[model samples]
Target: MKRWKIAGLFAMALMVSAAPFQAFATSPEFAYTAEKWASLRDNKLEYGEIADLIHEYNTTVRQNELDYQEYKGKTSTDIAEEYYDSANEVSERIRYPDDDSANYANQIASALNSEISVTNLTEQGDSNVDDGEIKRLGYEQQEKNLVQQAQKLMISYYSGKASLATLEDAVTQAETAYTQAQTRKAAGMALQSDLDTAAEAVTNAKASLQSAKSSLEQTKQQLIIMMGWNYNDSVEIGSLPDVDTSVVSKINVTSDIQTAIANNYSVKITERRLANSQSENNRATYTNTLANQKETVSTNVKNAYNSLVLAKDSYDQAKTSYDLAEKERAAAELRLSAGTITKKTYEKQESACLSAKTSMETAKLSFLTAQVTYDWAVAGLASVS
Candidate 1:
């Protein structure tokens, strides 16, 4: 009766031990969904977080690759981390066989298992684990890098000091118009047309404000999408710090144009794509003459260089126009307020001020576009080194 009671307790303990292993074997799968991805990105992720995730995933992939090589009867460069962890834990459980061991114990009733048996038991352990591995992402890295570059572009698009500077000058002009109208209304010294013109300037200012707001939101969305977020995902950016005026001032016609050609992300992309095209062309020509190939390459280089020069010249012109517009707008506003200008003249001044602001924004866009084009062109022709 005592033997049977011991058997019953042993069976109960076996079931209890096996239950956890069974549960672990059937662990739920790791899930990823669009909504969940959005939530995680919002709540737990940042730009740096993505970089860390890539690093960890790369490590796991390397481990898996080594294990795969080992399984294929090849020399692996590294051992599996899991293998080491398991070996350390299971070493304590292993005991050497003894010549005078008791025969009463069942074959499977030993307190510990041998190393070979343990390895066999755990051979399929990885099958049940959710490794959460992402595939080779070299191309994806380029895509991600481009997206990040795009975000920087969008920020510069909206929060540029050039645009802000132009807007401030316009605001001053509008305020001046308002003051002049008020003075004229009070003194009965202003024409009806003058009052009407002043009112129109205020309306234009409000319109300009709306335009800025719209552009800001659009650029913000562009940045969010570039960072690999859904269109509806909310992003709260910290305030933009003042861009280095020194850097801005350091941008000269010749040196900046040259630097932009080399460093602009867009230009680099274009350059890479063009080089890829050249390689494809070379590969396809099984019996082409060396001179012909050289000529073709030369032609491409010339076209790209010319394009860069044109872009640089356009940037220079835009900068001059923007500066001149700012000056003219400010002077016009001052003249209108001093009653030296008639209402019709004041309206013309308001128009000129708005035109200047618009010109400045356009110039900024042109400069960036050219800069990107030049960079991509250079990248096509040369390696990242």
Candidate 2:
């Protein structure tokens, strides 16, 4: 009997240990398990996965989604029915002559009042309003905003990396120039001022590189946290996909403006309010507000398109500059092979080419950001007035 009791106790403990996992598997509250979250933390995070991450892990997005899910298919009438049931329950309890009779009476009164209020509101409120859909859209917009933020941070982080590389090259070039200056000065071929300038360049280059590194790390931290990871969590960040320059040619500004106005969440909300307005004055006010909102959305889309155009132009110019730098670098390499230029001169040319490449990359990132903004505008996710 003692061994059987011990075995039963062990089985009970095992069941207790497994209960939480069983609950988690069946629970509607959690869309992901702890194991899933752990897997996400372990895997490399990519730019394309930001939207899904935000939906799954962002606190605000998760709360909104849960709220929407709870209220889905539940109308004001359903809420009023719930209130009526509470009132009826209180009334039933009041029939019993208990010591808390007076308190139960007050509770019944309050419940009845609440039920009446909800019923009246339901009768007067917009009959066509789908609260669930509105909440779902709100949740979607939150996720979109977070994803956009992550994209911007990712772009800045990669751009900073490119700039850091260019700075590192610049420092090497500066050190080489300083060494050559010292050699020339010793031979009475260069001035002390030249050596001083070279040393200053090296110092400035190192300082810039250090500052860039700090800024990049801060950006990475923000991006990681935004994607549902702890600020200091170590994870590999994948590269941004190549920008689709072809999208630029596909944009139709006029059509896009209409699509933006139609799909804008704020505009939809305002229209709903206008539809539910009881008084003529309230209706007119909301009407005017809705018109203003549509106009603002249109302007935002136009501005985003213009910005994209300017970014593309700048990118093109940078690409031209980079192409010229590449040719010059290639020519310098040939000259070095022929012993026509000193190693210091070749290294300086190499640094210049790197700088040009960094500039081109930075320009491309700017254009990509602009492209994303325009896309968001058309998708009704951009910032309106």
How high is the CA lDDT of each candidate model? 0.47, 0.73
> How many angstroms is residue 183 displaced in model 2 relative to the true structure, after the best TM-score fit?
4.7
RMSD for all candidates, in order, please.
20.1, 9.8
Instruction: List model 1 lDDT by residue over 77-181, tens digit each.
Output: 112345545755676676655556675254335534556655753553322211212111223334345533553455455545346555656677788878878
Highest TM-score against the true fold, candidate: 2
lDDT of 2 by residue, 1-385 (tens): 2222332343354345443222111222245577654445454678877776665556566445435545555654454455556555644544333556768777666666766665555454423343544555666676778788888888888888878888788777778778888999999998889889988998998898889899999999888777667777776889888976778888889999999988887888777667655568768888999999998998889999999999998999999999999999999999999999998789878888888999999999999999888888888775657
How many backbone overlaps does candidate 1 show? 9
**Which stretches of model 2 miss by more than 4 angstroms?**
1-42, 66-136, 180-200
* Model 2 TM: 0.72
